[model samples]
Target: MEEEVENILQKGGELFHPGLSVDCVIFGFHDNQLKVLLLKMKHADKWALPGGFVYKEEEVEHAAVRVLQSRTGLGNIFLRQFHTFGSPSRSDRKLNRELLVSLDLEAHENHWFLQRFITVGYYALVNFSSAVPRPDATSEACAWWDLQDMPPLAMDHNHILQQALETLRKQLNDQPVGYNLLPEKFTMPELQRLYETILGKQLDRRNFQRKMLGYGILDRLEERKRGVAHKAPYLYSFNKEKYAAALQDGLQQGW
Candidate 1:
């Protein structure tokens, strides 16, 4: 672990751009709740968003994709750049040095990782069951945390998360957003639950269904979901072509 940390720190100076990083708020939907992927630091009792430095040769967006893939083991995810955070105090050099010392690794005063970084904030929507989370070199555990029950996060991550969620909520008002966060086939109630979870409020069932159906982006299947105690609800799936078009063109209505 120490060697791996050393290698990453050394590589940061050689292969990554200085003073620039990418932090991703990877959102997932499962069990009718909204979740965000987070990492628990190895030697600290703190959680953080999945993030990393930008490689010198990589585009800022590609670097975000690489970071997300490394942490979540999923590719082709729905990713978006929402904002840039450049607060001078966002990075804490003293605490970073302490963490390295805890790992019994040398923390050089001039190390690139100790410098203040201006990070690009991105958010990704992925199917909860599809992702296999993996910790990075600095993190000991990688897992999902409910948005409302998140623990103390490191650095400016809590602020970053708030901004990401705000961006997601605002985007929900303008565009369609459930294709990647849900299974290929789902029920209307399931889809509505996902929206309600992100929006932090319940939508009127009839109105939500009418609005969704009116968008012309869903294909209702004739088959009903089986084995339910109550009357089975019909299954629905996104019409990929229309869904993609809706994503490109705004939904033109808000809840």
Candidate 2:
């Protein structure tokens, strides 16, 4: 692992952009809870957002997609760039030095990975059950943490996560969001729960149903959820054509 770190830093200049990085806030919805994917560092007890440096030949957006795909093993993810963090002190040299020391490696003053970085923040929405989280060389574990109970993140990651969440909440007013977060067929109550979780509040059920149906993005299936003791709720799925159209041209109403 020490050799691997040395090798990566040695080739960093040839392989990746020096001062630009991409950080992803991958959100997943499960059991009515909102979760974010996080990586636990290999030799340290710190956690961080899944992130990586942009390749020298790659576009920033493509770098974000690549970072997410490598971590989550999911290709078709809904991603949106939210912000750029470029504070001069954003990169914590102290933390970097501690991490390197933990790996039993020493980096010189001119090391590429030790430089100041401007990170582009992107938020991705994926189906909770579809992702197979995998850690990178610097991390030992990749797993989902509930948004309500997330651990302290390294660097400016907590702020980045908050900004991403705020952007997602604002986007809910204009875009269709649940298509990637929910299963192929789901109940209206389930969909409502997803929205409520993201918004951090409870929504009136009847009003939510009316607005969602009026958007014309959902198809009400004849079948209902099975194996429930109470009267089963009717199942619904996104109308792909309408959903795509809605996503292309903003939705008519806001929640």
Candidate 3:
């Protein structure tokens, strides 16, 4: 074995390369489609979301961004901290237990493989047009998958992804940031797609439009996509300041 690998085992007790790791469940929307980021783990023959350990001096968020950049080649994208997963079962002993038996290592070190560890989960909202997926040192490759059709994943990654979906829904339901899924300039149907995806229900177009217009968070623009056969819908952008101000006063949009 290599010296670095030797040292890892030397210091390893059941902690299994333990450190403060951040996992990003990156989500993107394009053409009214929803997707999530996933990566293939090296030597594991399994797919997982991109994750990495924090440097000793790195801030929690900085670590997450580093992981994102290192794995996905995406830097400085907006990501939100949602929840932490730290169950004894989550950092599963079964995975480590198999490794321990296969490696012919001392039994004492086996516990280190199974030791409890905490993982902070963050969800990033990426502009599908901007994100360029890349694999990290510990991954073989990376790609985005449709939420409607995801491949099998390792290490509770599917759970993490589900958590992200729930978080996005909560944000849409309460905070109602159409910006999470819509572009800077969007048409009415484009805006509605974002809400429908998050809320997981088909909305009545006329009623929904009436209610959204009443919110007064939309700023109409003169621009419109040219050459469409139908009446080209007018362009509009979110009034972020107005929405934030409303949030301050306890106005919320429930899912």
Candidate 4:
């Protein structure tokens, strides 16, 4: 697997491009906000996207799913094919040899720096409602960071995050995302927060409610959140199977 293909990029071989890997930027929403899952390297203290190399016998998408599961401890979530980034400069785009040296990976036996890598980026949607995240071998910790106040991430990860967000927004132009960030049941406020976070814009409360309900994709739960100041809000959940089917058609957002 360490065999170099030599001048691969120039001759359409794999060697010059180095080893190709896939990194996943998984996002989940909870408590009425959007959050990104991140892992901090042991020595660097700086966070990087969850990533792993494709096994010789494994599929690229499968490899990405495996990496996301390895780091976030959540699997079988809905993931989409977003984009592939291949810029030679992107290799040194975020962390470099110096950064990896600080991580002391040599001592940990994870000498990832020696090999050249080109990563394909994939973003997944996970339900924060029922997910428990954990750190993998290369990371000191795995935690959720709110997108609104995200710190400077390592490498082109900030670009990765932006790409994921843009993909999500484009999805929203036709369909509703952020369902993974919601609970099995949530209020309109929770739904609105998810949209606002992704679109980076506030919407009218009443109009938002009218539009969401009118879509007829939600299943009103029997119960409601209690003890606020005004009226108790009813709980709601998306008909995932049905909503998924609708994607084959089209979602009219009333323009």
Q: Each candidate's lDDT (Cα)?
A: 0.89, 0.90, 0.73, 0.72
Question: Which prediction has more favorable TM-score, 2 or 3?
Answer: 2
Report the Cα RMSD per candidate: 1.8, 1.7, 4.1, 6.1
How good is model 3 by TM-score? 0.80
All candidates: TM-score? 0.94, 0.95, 0.80, 0.80
Q: Compare the candidates by lDDT and give the number of the best one.
A: 2
Each candidate's number of clashing pairs is: 0, 0, 6, 4
User: Which stretches in model 2 have alpha-carbon errors above 4 Å?
Assistant: 1-3
List ranges where model 1 is wrong by over 4 Å: 103-106
Candidate 4 structure quality by residue, lDDT tens digits, 98-186: 54444332322233444456788898889875667777655677888998888768768899889988998888867766566776778
Model 3, total clashes: 6
lDDT tens per residue, model 1, 39-94: 99887889999998888889999999999899888998889999999999998787
TM-score of 2: 0.95
**Runs in model 4 with CA error above 4 Å?**
1-18, 93-116, 252-255
Q: Rate residue 247 of model 2 by lDDT.
A: 86
Between prediction 2 and prediction 3, the one with superior lDDT is 2
Q: Report how far off residue 197 is in candidate 2 (Å).
A: 0.4
